[model samples]
Target: MILTDIVSRIYVLNLPERKDRKKEIEHALKQIGIHWQANQVICWPAIRPSSNNNFPSVGAYGCFLSHVAALQDACHAEHGWALILEDDAVFASDFNTQLPELAKVLSSEQADLIYLGHCHVASETAAPAGLNISTAAVIGAQGYLVRIAYLATLLPYLEACISRPAGHPLGGRLHYDGALSLFRQFNPSCRTWIAQPSWIEQRFSRSDIQAHWWYDRWPLLRQCAAWARKFKQARRHAATLN
Candidate 1:
């Protein structure tokens, strides 16, 4: 199935300052035989207005709003489906080969949403080429396909999260992806799936959404720190379980 047939519009979350990222995604698309310039992913510009609600940072708030804007555009369009891509997305070699199957699975499962890539997936050797979608370990908003009709059900929950809360018994994060998971949780009818061996991965460049003065300047330091802290805590948790 041709992508154009299923996904009528592709929106790339891009910032004006980040021409380099736009170039990278465009090249990746071309490699996969998608003429990005011809198709022209509507480059959604970055917005950074002040957010009164709590977030990790201003960047995080902007990122959340940006995803919302992309989804809104997708919903408004009469397109069949919408492919929302973060500018940092780099396509994989297998991505092109997998498109037809991906399209098929999405149709067969009637998935309202499917992640092209995310943080992790189960190493299911049994069904390598089959749908490796699982219920957990799939988080992040970098790359995903959204069925046009499902947005109506989704937008309310997302918009609700934006409002100054009245009161909720449970604590939850309000980041875009987190809100997505919450929506899926509250409404089991929202069929969500994930692609195995992710079609896209975050480019190794510094993040526009979550950059830090020190980390962006010296990324290796950030990686090393994460490794050191996370690994130590992981081992500690394992010991407690044992």
Candidate 2:
């Protein structure tokens, strides 16, 4: 199988209304020598929030469902791993060269989920020298790879959250990436990681979900908080393992 085929599947999430975004992503991928067929680039319709919806806005809900859709697809895929990307995600120039190395690391480590591109607000200290992967704290959903085995666990949990009554404790106050972080915290079996220097980065574009200025302005503070949370979670995970 070709190097691209090493990944069971690759998907780019696009909205029907964002045809321009789709074209832009296609162009970017072409520049990187990756060409995806129409079936591989899934166009998800944005979910409009209503009075009965759990999330704060239609955009938030749509974003959440789009990720769920990706996970659902991975659960049924014949391949062991899948790569999911948002339309605005851009590949690093070395991404093609690093793809095999990444796949080998994740497979050897048996990681459930790995962030390909995300904000660097998860840890205060750098990863051990030469280590490409470290535990993820607060990941952005722009680009990630998921193991099909882990999706088997994650998909059911997400479905449960979706079916819960409005106002339920686990209902919809959080974004999809946040929910995934919480899930990893609670479920030690679901290993997660981030690439030290991300292989992809999100291109600036009109965001579908609302933005928080506080997060943008105080990234160091956010990273500190994430580190604290991860520390507590590591302690708890250790207790369980013991």
Residue by residue across 113-168, what tens digits does model 1's lDDT show? 88886666534443354355545535677888888888888776777676635234
Could you give candidate 2's per-residue lDDT for residues 115-179 as a string of tens digits?
87776647777675222545557668788888877777788777766666545666444567777
User: Which prediction has the highest lDDT against the true structure?
Assistant: 1
Runs in model 2 lying further than 4 Å from the true structure: 1-3, 38-52, 128-133, 165-171, 211-242
Best by TM-score: 1
Q: Would you give me the overall lDDT of model 2?
A: 0.67
Give each prediction's root-mean-square deviation over alpha carbons: 7.3, 10.6
Q: Per model, how many backbone clashes are there?
A: 0, 0
What are the Cα lDDT values of the candidates?
Answer: 0.69, 0.67
What is candidate 1's local distance difference test score?
0.69
Off by over 4 Å in 1: 37-40, 121-133, 164-173, 213-242
Q: Score residue 82 of candidate 1 by CA lDDT.
A: 81
**Each prediction's TM-score versus the true structure:** 0.78, 0.76
Residue 10's lDDT in candidate 1 = 84
* Alpha carbon lDDT at 196, candidate 1: 64
Report the Cα lDDT for residue 134, model 1.
46
